[model samples]
Target: MFKGLKPIQYAGREVWPLIEGGKGVSATNHASSGAWAAAGGIGTVSAVNADSYDEDGNVIPQVYEGRTRTDRHQELIDYAIEGAVAQVERAHEIAGGKGAININVLWEMGGAEAVLQGVLERTKGKVAGVTCGAGMPYRLSEIAKQYGVYYLPIVSSGRAFRALWKRAYHKVPELLGAVVYEDPWLAGGHNGLSNAEDPTKPEDPFPRVKQLREMMRKEGISDDIPIVMAGGVWFLRDWNDWIDNDDLGKIAFQYGTRPLLTKESPIPDIWKDELTKIEEGDVLLHKFSPTGFYSSAVKNPFLRSLQGRSERQIPFSTEKAGEHTHQLDVGVKGKNFWVAAGDLLRAREWDGQGFTTALKTPDNTLVFVTPEERAMIRKDQADCMGCLSHCAFSSWKDHDNYSTGRLADPRSFCIQKSLQNIAHGADPHENLMFAGHAAYNFKTDPFYSNGFVPSVKELVDRILTGD
Candidate 1:
């Protein structure tokens, strides 16, 4: 049904209107990317920990081996680059005779430039463009030009677009293909939600897209440069009014969560079922991340556990200034419960529930709960393969020193280990599951069969035809 659509010029290549948003970990892979490209549009393959595995699913050799954080990060860079190149080659092969293929990069991730260079140098002319987000990719234009590929920056506002254009647009003018406007409130993964933009106030995207288009034109950016709309994009009918409009003449739609249901998507069936049964308030945007940014995810047992921990925590002062700080003797052998009067009741409640295990971190801070839960946490830590550059749970970092300076926060977990587990069909109740708010629609949408599976073509066609 996407017939008769005019070709949009992107990085010297004519591409279709569809652009698939990149999802990390194995969610958005070469198969799904190739399928999207096969539809004559731009398909983005995620490169987060790209060098994570080889064709046979084996780990590559460490590129660096030093105690320092910089050294460790450097090694990670080399591995990621090699992995990205492999993924790109696979995607290129699958694209076959289809349209252009693009790579998605997370600027916040360690070794961003090295990984990009690795993919570009290896792929050479095979890749058409690179899309970067998670941070303000100030040097993206420079990198894209060096590799001779188009660049697309995912932005949330017109002001952000203007700022990037003024800083780096001149050097890579020809390479600026499109601007992805991801709705901070509606999208999954790391959100761009600002302090002022309340989650309660859901803004219509059409007006925002129009504003960005006008801002682009003011900055001498041509009208031909498409503004790709992402987040909460379920069906074409939801965006019918935004499409083919004068203000947003050349527009494209990017799908992040909806693509997970497709056959080409790499997520397991168990995770897909969770998305189907999710309710309206089941998806939450929380500020618990140590990155100091908001993230969206399902309110499953994993998330609820964290929420409960936050609620039960109390401030303790060394001075004898508070009424709550009291040394209390415990019946358990060789254990003392340092409880505030307020926390005393909570501790008693846990004790009545038969929770006897109390674990302490390196800082000597205690978290008293159930032994069974602690064992699960310990198992999750043991299974960690050091996916993220630094993890609070395992205290694993690219360097000997804390890279993000957040190794002690109980609020943070090893994202890599948890995501990998969930993606591999591990216990959904324990592992964190990232999803868009529109995930709940899976239950009502006829496009999904039994809330479990749908072919890539079917999902894409449903999006294009608004079914």
Candidate 2:
């Protein structure tokens, strides 16, 4: 037995309680979000580096011509604004007065405020709301209010929402569309795990969401405001208890990973096929993103290479001390490099295996890699467009002299480049792929039997049956 969902009032219209989670780098575009909205659910167009088309209808490739990181960052912001405005306009047109259309952006992305303002100014009456996460977007409410649209702040915990309410959101409560409670442990892409939370031990989202509601009540916020549950959502039947529960208040569901397999999904066919092969534990939660946030991705060759590079690391000192009594003879041309005796032997072993290059990390550690790997790392770092506010990979900061004042880390990669490549039909195994933990359900769900992929409407209709 399953409980069916009822249409709820959103943006002054009746629509299903379902929502399509926004994915970045052209993953969620007009085709997907439009069809989702037409199916009577809220659809979110990703405003993070979305794609814009040429006059002939081909997607314009985003090629950076600026020589400096700051110059290129401006180019990126312009591209982002144009792309998001185009996407929202097209998505609204496709919806045809059916369901609401929202745009999602990462607060930590470079020039996030500028891009958001630009898109909102251009797509005045087209977009219904804005969804933001990845950092504390204290100005999101004000920006949404300026454009006469609702704002949804994605948070992982009740404490975070309380902080936001106390800081800025309380001033503009009317246009607060929904609070998205994204499960940090189960969510894909960048997670919101704080220093207080442990990565290994997963907590049940029911209790955490209940706490969020209780906090909201303390602030005198009405129960009518839906708390959209995102991340790890697969079959709606598993969440039957959450529906119509008094303690949880108004509830909604957001699908991030499940929507990627639909016919309207903008992801490449190779990515869609790869989603069906995921097994339990195949998606790993790791801390290798340039933004310094924990993210989840398939443990493919690209991710494994980062892991191996990190594993082959050792702490070094400029001069010999108590623990660093051995002089490093391999990988480095400098004679001042010192390491422990055990590390010295390991470095020699790695060098013998052709990992003859050593790169320094920001944490005073050295990672061994082959010459070709080192060259690729250097090239990627040089090609950075300052996508993030603060990037650990290239040490490129968005403000204050455009540097993080730390050594450029080799453990992370340029997320913008990899994501752009993957979105435009790059090999999934060689680029970064973001997915939720429940993605494994794609392989076992009977609705997807015989390699069948449903249209966005079919998927939405099937979901209403509690499948």
Best by lDDT: 2
Give stretches of model 2 more than 4 Å off.
1-4
* Residue-by-residue lDDT tens digits, candidate 1, 130-234: 888777888999999898888999888887888888888766788898899999888898887767788778788788888999998887788778899888888
User: lDDT of each prediction vs. the true structure?
Assistant: 0.73, 0.94
Q: Score every model by TM-score.
A: 0.85, 0.99
Assess candidate 1 and give its TM-score to the true structure.
0.85
Q: Candidate 2, which ten residues in sequence have the lowest lDDT sum?
A: 1-10
Candidate 2 residue 455 Cα shift, in angstroms, is 0.2
Query: What is the C-alpha lDDT profile of model 2 across 1-467, one tens digit per residue?
Result: 24657888998899999999999989999999999999999999999999999999799999999999899999999999999988998999999999999999999999999999999999988888999999999999999989999999999999999999999999999999999999999999999999999999999999999999999999999999999999998888989999999999999999999889999999999999999999999999999999999999998999999999999999999998889999899998979999999999999999999999999998889999999999999999998898999999999989889999999999999899999999999999999999999998899999999999999999998888889
Global CA lDDT computed for model 1 = 0.73
Using alpha carbons, what is the TM-score of model 2? 0.99
Q: What lDDT does candidate 1 reach at residue 93? A: 89
